[model samples]
Target: MSDVPPPWLPEDIDETFDPLEHADIEPSPETPLIVTPRGGDREVGRSCYQVDTQHGRYLVDCGLSQGTSDKFPDLRGLQPQSIDAVFLTHAHVDHCGGLPVLENRNLLADNAPVVTTPPTASIASLMLEDSLKIHRRETDGSSAVQQFTSRDVAEVCDRFHTVGYGGGRIEGVAPVSDVEPAIFQLGNTAHLLGSAWVVIQTSGYRVCFSGDLGGRATHLPDMSPPPESGLLMLESTYGDTHSHPSLSGARTGLWEDIERAIQTREPVLIPTFAIGRAQTILLIIAERLHTLSADLRDRVEIVLDGMAVEGTDIYHEYVEDTNYFAESLVNRVVESGETEPFFAESFTIPETDQDRQKILTRAARDGTVPVIISPSGMLTGGNSPRYLAEFTARFGNASVFLTGYQAANTTGRTLQSQYQADQETVSATIDATPFSTDWPESSDVQWVHAENTGDSELKTRISFSADWISLVEGLSGHAAQSGLLSFARTVAPDTIGLIHGPDYAQERLGPHLAENVAGVDQVTRSRRMTPIAVGSETDVDTAVISPEEIDSTGYTELEDQIDHLYELLSKLNEEVASARNEPGLSEAEIREVIQDEMEIKE
Candidate 1:
């Protein structure tokens, strides 16, 4: 991504590290390519795709859609039992959250080999375990039978077949049952630590799946050079438009906000995703702190909250093995075995209420300012809500910096919209627990009033006299419109299928791909269940690609398993009702028996 290594990078590593050039990749060409997008078409989540050939059936990235009702991929017409393998791109929940559920429910082949980079395997373990814990707490047993348990996630991790990027090493070519042998290789996409663009050779053709390609380098890895493919399935998360602040501009904007907060002795609050975004923020602050004045540095403190602490630890864990991190920083942490080497310079990770109160009290003192980084980047949940309630409403002593995208329906988006409203007219539910719990108005505290200047949309910064809020860009993991187009042109696939983006993104990227890639037979934007047959000259739009025509033994098996589970549960419920109605058993006796049974099960 850069010809010259930044000053922060170690001198030992090569500036031009192209992982693709030396890859010993070999592609086999077959015919009758069939692709059915199970999810992540015309939307940004639940990104699963089914690719079928005479050789095998493959499921790519079984993710969950984050929404009012979270959705898993539509495996309606395919049998999970027939799936030869599961290939994961990265560990982002939206891209890989459904794996444990699928495998646990027998929707996937029994202990099917899951292939991904090593770092991704670790990250996915953390995310999956965290998700199940959080889900159980949130639902409080109100939901139906669990799809997967923590034990199931542990099993999934044990079954992961790890692979490394570059050097053309094809992993998992062994045939699963009668399925034809297939080979897959991973290349760094630079989207996240272990993120990669997969190239699978099967069915006599090479298929490339761009699993969230990153357009530019941040503190993480750089995008690998494009690999040749007969059929290309690309992500269009940022394909609709290319206009956004440059990484440098974003950094400058954040720095200005921090400087202002420092001068005013006000605290700064940054809401970010714990995984990628928070790590980037920490790297930025750690690198820049050396340039600050001694007095300012002593007076300022940086705090991490939520999953960011664990995510940052994982970042350091991979420092020695991955090129994405600076070697100097990695060596320091590695040598000292410090969970957070950056914390040596006034950084805090509050564990209890007392710790938080102490930090808040210290920040309230004159000449001392604290910068807080919290999670659930969208502000829909996590510690960010608490921080936002405390900081954003204040005038003259604080600022909020949104460092990434704010998807619709999220609190982050609501805050952004309110910031753009003409007056303090846009009301929102902050849902923060006030510092003084005994306050009489605490129960009624949901609405927050902030004077909006209504100019946030015109630019990144919104000023309201002494207080402000800014939207900083260049933190997005997806490639820009031109970047996606250029990547497609470089790959120059015979057929292209777009997914993992909104309708607007797909609509814009499809034409751009068709125009840019010469001799392209078709560039189709896929919706759920839409099949784009590879090596077929027929126009995809007019083609009748029915679900029945596709060999979906995998989805069929999944359906049967689900039906069986439901039948079993229904029978148990009926039995329980019959027992309750039995003449010999009193109501009290029945209740006691059911409670005893539940305890026994537990």
Candidate 2:
């Protein structure tokens, strides 16, 4: 055999070499900070990043992916015992779902604490518990191995070290013994209640991790500006879009739709994320309840179901905390002596299957439109699907409003596709345990009773005639292209790495930032498992891949240009065809217009 050793092996090693034996390890000030994206690279879910510094190794976020093959972060080369701490930005599932997995796999070090804001810790507990239930239900009869257990979730929560926003220098979190700890600060991101963007200064390097920035939500304060850094890892979830629909306009449209549904006596089902979106929707409805006609307002009943009940309770728990909520919410809800800012006068929280059934039955019987808001925004889990199935089976004419991003392969995405296509009927198979009832033999729903199958749950296929299936825009927690560019400009980092977005979005955002943002020497679409080194004095390694160099030279730019040209051509063709149908348009005039357009293109 050759004398060369594997890359993983130590140089000049012999068989007698003890793995634990080592020379004195000293902190090197010149060591460049190495950031390796373990997840949330070129995709939206499972946001994780491994940072290796001179002082210690740390993780920015440990999260799980939904509706994708790779549900967990790439933990192949990660040693759980080596991680000093986990910096969680918020309580969203995609940003905190994998903490339990870390514990389950024995990856988390015994002394390593999960550092986050207090609001994040509280909401994350609820989110993790719900996630565990879904995980257990999904893996009930299958051979798929469970990623984590309830005990693991509890352990993860117990390890959380709550810190307030703008808190400088995290205490009791040193990466290496006897070395100076990293100085970090959390700024309000305005994405979720406790969301914050983390800026860490360690080993002579300042790195900023933009953990899901947001400024669109009216219930939360504007996102705080992050301090300048040498390296900025920013989320690009909406990088391909210029801007969102006006929040006021979206709210107006939603209220108008709800009013129309109420006027027609059709129940409206709104499937929303339990944490942020549900609370926002509730606030919107509550604020406008008085504006509705007295007769219509008296007939409208708001129903909050499933995990949203607990999620709202958590929101109320922190209602007075100015660090988490906006001044308007705190003043109007807490200072004004309002019992609850997120609930209408005629709101109901169904605690059991019987209550849920009664709500639907009463609504159908009395023809009083009930606006039902439930969790599992994607309709992938929770009681939303059960409600959806029951609604489809019970109501002939009803409205379903989807308020957030619906990932691919989800029932929400399926319904959204049908809605966009204006299909007369929408159909999908959903997993749920129906309320105790006996369906007629000629029912349209293909029901599989849990008792008949000896399982705890049933999967049923239900179809419904189109009745106002709407995808409400401007409710997203993520900032669009303009906001991202603005944030980048404010930070003005030398290098930027885009994460927590799809390939197309990152591809569009990477070059856009490089072209627009000044002082950005490099802009890259973060790739999972790739190591990017950032340091002031050190030369960037050749391993760092720029967005422009993702494919062949100038490929991304050319593709963007080609897409623009095609759009222009399509518009020109439409104009020419419309002119041809006009009474006075001639072939010569069309030729002139086409020639002028061609010259402009040249």
Candidate 3:
């Protein structure tokens, strides 16, 4: 939230917020208080939150993740017309990328005055258009699912309205218009160029939503959580202390690993987010190779897959609120390019088919002394997979390096599967909640190694799931988590609902006032389907919240649905067992595992 008032805000501060402020907003304990996390829970990124009161409704960040394609918030599901307004926190694809897709959707009403600060609005437009372009390129001319194209994104600009760090306005409409009702205050979270931590104020309640807490005082500004809040929806990206590694430590470790891989004369593969991490990794690599140690220099061959060079520009434009590392990273890529003709003036960008082929050919060679960098940070869907298929064939002494938070069910997560070579074939359904237990064993992962084609040694790479990277970055950008907690504690809400991060992160986040987040009380959450929890007893449709009670109102029904599958599979397994040596593993044995997992579900 900046000092300037958005066109949507009312001129009268104490007078009252717009009624449209709470469109489609759910009910909350604070006369008008309502908090609903649309995405980023029990998973990572694509975060959206709704704050509503009987008076009005307003949304804080409306982005998407893999799950966004699911029924509710996708272009098809959301009634954009009903949304009163939208507040953007930052420009990260996960946090702000989904807005444009809203245009493609059919809406109940059709106007949410997509409100955001100037910087965030400008940058998100550009980043989202780029994302749409890439998505279309990959989708074979079909309607790219869950992606917004440049034209669609351009349409979004018309909806673009401005807000400052303090408070902006979107005037017109009654305090209790047809739109849901609520009041929201947003301030810079400093997580990125224009990130913001949201504050929801209702007639009788107050809640502070910690969008995505940034890290400690890194190169960027440190954010502190508000001192008190009736309800605190904080992101525990770094909830566990284990995630507390200094950036310097990560930098040092990354260098050691890269140097070792290069020594064997193999390419070092790093799959990173085009938004931020990709450049950060390169700068660190350059610093380690050039300025830090001379031995680290020559062996390092840097190669890029796509428009990562352009992404550096996006980060550069927002340098004021961004960290020194990100700002300097743009400059670093330029200097590194100037180091030699291949990268410097003669930059061999992969625009045409032939260019892409060359980039791949060079990076795939055994003696090809280069560090190949690509976008699709989590390796979910990008050129990274193509390289893996090509280079790993020969067992080159190479490795794949991952440096972003991988969303569930994505190709990024699939890479961790143990059995692989030219192709991957394994799928085990996972329980999304209760974090620690869900992390598949390290053995299940296929380690990166060099494929040797006679004398040529092509190296695959290692992976890094920077789980705490968000938490740490969020802390520094928002007020420190401590400051935010103060605001939550003060609000003293009767019911607190948590959303917008992996379940592990929320599970790890203790209540700002020492209570457990999922430990009963009035709250609602979902992994795949819907689970609604209510505090007050008056509502007929809502379930009552009891202390120490873990709400699972629909758990039984969902379990039954899952059970049905297990039962069929079990029967199939028995029949398949009749065939002693069958292709694709005994159907019966596969059934057994499903049956066993089903039992565990109960």
Which candidate leads in lDDT? Answer: 2
Residue 363 of model 1 has an lDDT of 72
lDDT tens digits by residue: candidate 3, 482-597: 33333345445454455554555454343322333222244433221122222333232222334444433222333333433543343244224312212223434554676576
C-alpha local distance difference test of each model: 0.65, 0.76, 0.48
State which candidate has the highest TM-score.
Answer: 2
- Once fitted onto the true fold, the runs of candidate 3 whose alpha carbons sit more than 4 angstroms away are 1-30, 37-46, 53-55, 67-80, 106-112, 130-151, 169-184, 202-204, 236-243, 292-296, 320-350, 356-368, 393-395, 419-495, 502-513, 516-602
Candidate 1 or 2, higher lDDT?
2
lDDT of 1 by residue, 358-437 (tens): 77767765557888898878876777876655543333447778888898887778778877664443335543554444
Poorly placed runs, candidate 2 (over 4 Å): 1-28, 68-70, 439-442, 448-458, 537-602
- In every candidate, how many clashes are there? 13, 1, 119
Position 591, candidate 3: lDDT: 45
The stretch of ten residues in a row with the least summed lDDT in candidate 2 is 18-27
What C-alpha lDDT, on a 0 to 100 scale, does residue 561 get in candidate 2? 37
Cα error, candidate 2, residue 321 (Å): 2.1
Candidate 2 — which pairs collide? 80-107
